[model samples]
Target: MKDTVMGTLSQRLEENQIQLNQLLGKSTDLVTKELQLDSSTHIALVYIDGLVDTQVLHNSILYSLQEGAIQDQFKDLDPFQKLELLRKRILIAGDLSVTHDFKQFVHQLMSGNVMVLVDGTADALRIGLPGWEDRNVSEPNSQSVVRGPMEGFTENMRTNTALIRRKIKDSQLWLETFQIGKVTQTSVSIMYLTHIASPDLVQEVKSRLGKIDTDSILESGYIEEFIQDKAATPFPTIYNSDRPDTIAAGILEGKVAILVDGTPFVLLVPTFFVSFFQSSEDYYQRSDISTLLRFIRFLSFFITLFAPSFYVAVTTYHQEMIPTSLVISLAAQRESVPFPAFVEALLMELTYEILREAGVRIPKNVGQAISIVGTLVIGQAAVSAGLISSAMVIIVSITAISSFVIPESGMAVAARIIRFALIGLAGFMGLYGILFGVFLIILHLASLRSFGMPYMSPIAPYRSSDLKDSIFRFPWPLLKTRPSNNKIQDLKRQDTSKREGSAYDREK
Candidate 1:
């Protein structure tokens, strides 16, 4: 029975039921309803329990089919014609389709669609009635903002796409969907502005997505790993955000967004290195304030990436870089500590990372208490026991706080991992090693590409027109063009107009 392949529905009703039961392993959720059609013919409705809405199934399908009008309509028709009549006129389900392929019918049935089979018909009617519990849309836990829209994406794919649609209600905002993951069959959607997005980049993204042959794509992270350009690099070539406004902004900027089912986070492609430092709030604030915040973020990024490494380099190798008084103070503090500068920094950084991970993985109620206790006990005990220096603790704490200033978590994670490498290099050769490491990182970033767009756009290649929105965003009036790196079809984002009484004279 397991080896038997299902074919066209047999004239015998019992055989069809047996085959369906065998295919579904006779699961308890496999519900079958037998309804008599007049005195001669019968129909079997098969659907999974807890998947379909019972009210919809009863009112739209069962009630309509059990009516005397439907029985009269099907009384004289043959089984094949009766199936067509039921699908076309009798079934009240909004989404109705007919399929003769046994495999397709089974798949549809599993996907929360009711399959209708008549005794002598070779075809089956698939009625869409998917009803599954899902979480309500709420504020994003990861990317909260003070000035942006509070609504975040939900796990439902349709709802997520609809959220984007609500923001940019343009027909040009196109969505192309694909089903990846052979086993999970996760629905993946690629969204872009058809006129603004580059066709070549879009095609490249599509090609990459089509090439994914994984067994499961449980989250956007899985797709990110499969499609990213520099898989070995710690820096994320692709950006992901749970905020719909963020994804919409990416689309309007000629980037493509991939929305994976079952996850709120959506991936944005053709992302530049500078983009990770930006937040949606940047656009909401005054340009001057935004520019200031942007500069602060860049400064924080440098501090996070190089603070520990620079400490190791200066304390262990080049004591002259710091003031003589501060150097004396740091040395006096570390006099009782037995570990080297590298070991001390590494131990404190690893301890912070462990606490951070535990806070994230543990339950919400107990996580804060654990993290507070762990940090207090570890920091205080380490300093008192001379396992690490007080200065090292302060440096590590500052570095950790600076890491939180970066807007994107993936880029922050890359910085965190790279911080250890930089620290190791600094320990080896002091300031020269740190400079060498920074040079290599810059070179690697310049060489990287995301969907054919340079990772370090508007800076490495030096597009002055696009730089207005890079490190420091110019006023909206001065910013009238889209990013040149994208090479989109429609370049001019908005028309520029000269102010009547501006400082500079208006040219004809």
Candidate 2:
């Protein structure tokens, strides 16, 4: 059947019913309950079986339609008037919409809404009683904080948006919704502060989302990959968080947040390189503690990216650079191993990666224990069999631990990939190769852009004002302005002139 047949509904409910059934392909879950209101009026309630609230349908809507009191009012009213009367006074559903198109009726029916078709009316009422099973709001698994809001986003987009609203609670906070995915017709929404986020940024984000022509958007990650500034780069140009407070904070800082249905992770745009190391907990804790943790994260980034490669480079080409005794000890440990430093390190790293992947794929109850035991046993056995050196094991272990210290898994994964590339470079050209790799990495970071903002914002572009919250967060009283890199309209974050106490009285 052509869409034209279902595009416009007839005055007769029977024709509309046939067209709706044709559009729906008469699916197994398509439910239709026929009801008679007095002598002249007839209505059909169409909805998917599992998607709608059966309790609401049976207790409120059906009971009201079948009530003797309402039957007297419907006797003299026309079909359209009857629908109007039901919509204005009788329907007990919390949310309702009227639509004239059959296509919209099918869409609403698919989205877990009940559609009511009157016998002689063209307009139908769409009841919002969606009752799909969803996971309750829970603590985030990937990004947990020692001190901050414990609640995280749920898979439902409406629930996620509510969580953000609860955090910000400002009138300027706005949300724009889009139905992407040609087939799935997934609900996607972008939220930002009207006064804080730049108008151009908002329009640009809408433009990118409009241009996407995919058939399905299953998760927020799908939108991220499609709309990111650069697709080929290992470093993520877009940042995502499962915590609502983190997203709300981003919105307050002039970043737009993308929320997709069926996903807990919400994406924040115009992310800078330093953002990967920063956490929501940083703002919750004292400035000094956040600064220390921030410094440690930066240190961990370097260690995770360079530890194994640096070890390989030094042992292969700069053994003299090490202390004399340590060099002798390292050399003695490696003497029994058959492979060269690079090969040995590569084998150990690959083994660790395998074990790490296995731990994630296995049952959660024993995953961590299995991975740890597997690593220890494999490392000791490799050394005992002279297949690898003890020094290489220590380097790999340190590198693994350091990688976990980075807050963002995406950034940590990027470092891991670059680590392997650096290891290969060291295997061929030693320390000089490592230096060359680092230079290239820095150059790439400098060139990268996240939605037209520099990836290495405060560092590469050298914004002094923004640096207050970048690598080391300055005190709340001292930090009075929002990040300048975002070019937001509202720059003042707090009133610096009103100091609360003499405890922060270091400067005039």
Best by TM-score: 2
Clash count for each candidate, listed in order shown: 0, 0
Tens-digit lDDT track for model 2 on 109-161?
A: 88999999999988999999999899999899889899898999999999999
lDDT (CA) per prediction: 0.86, 0.90
Residue pairs clashing, model 2 = none
Clashing pairs in 1: none
Model 2 — TM-score against the truth? 0.97
In terms of lDDT, model 1 sits at: 0.86
Runs in model 2 lying further than 4 Å from the true structure: 1-6, 500-508
RMSD of 2: 1.5
Tens-digit per-residue lDDT, 1-508, candidate 1: 1234445556666777888777778599999999996887789999999878879999878988887766667667888898888887888685899887676677678778898888887788899988878789899978879997999999999899999999999989999999887667788999999999988989999999999998888999999998988788999999999999999988998989999999999999888999999999999989999999989999999999999999999999999889999989998988899999998888888888899889889998887556545765798889999888888878887887788889999889999999999999999999999999999998899899987788898998899889989999877766778888888888787755546455422431
Pick out the ten consecutive residues of candidate 2 with the lowest summed lDDT.
1-10
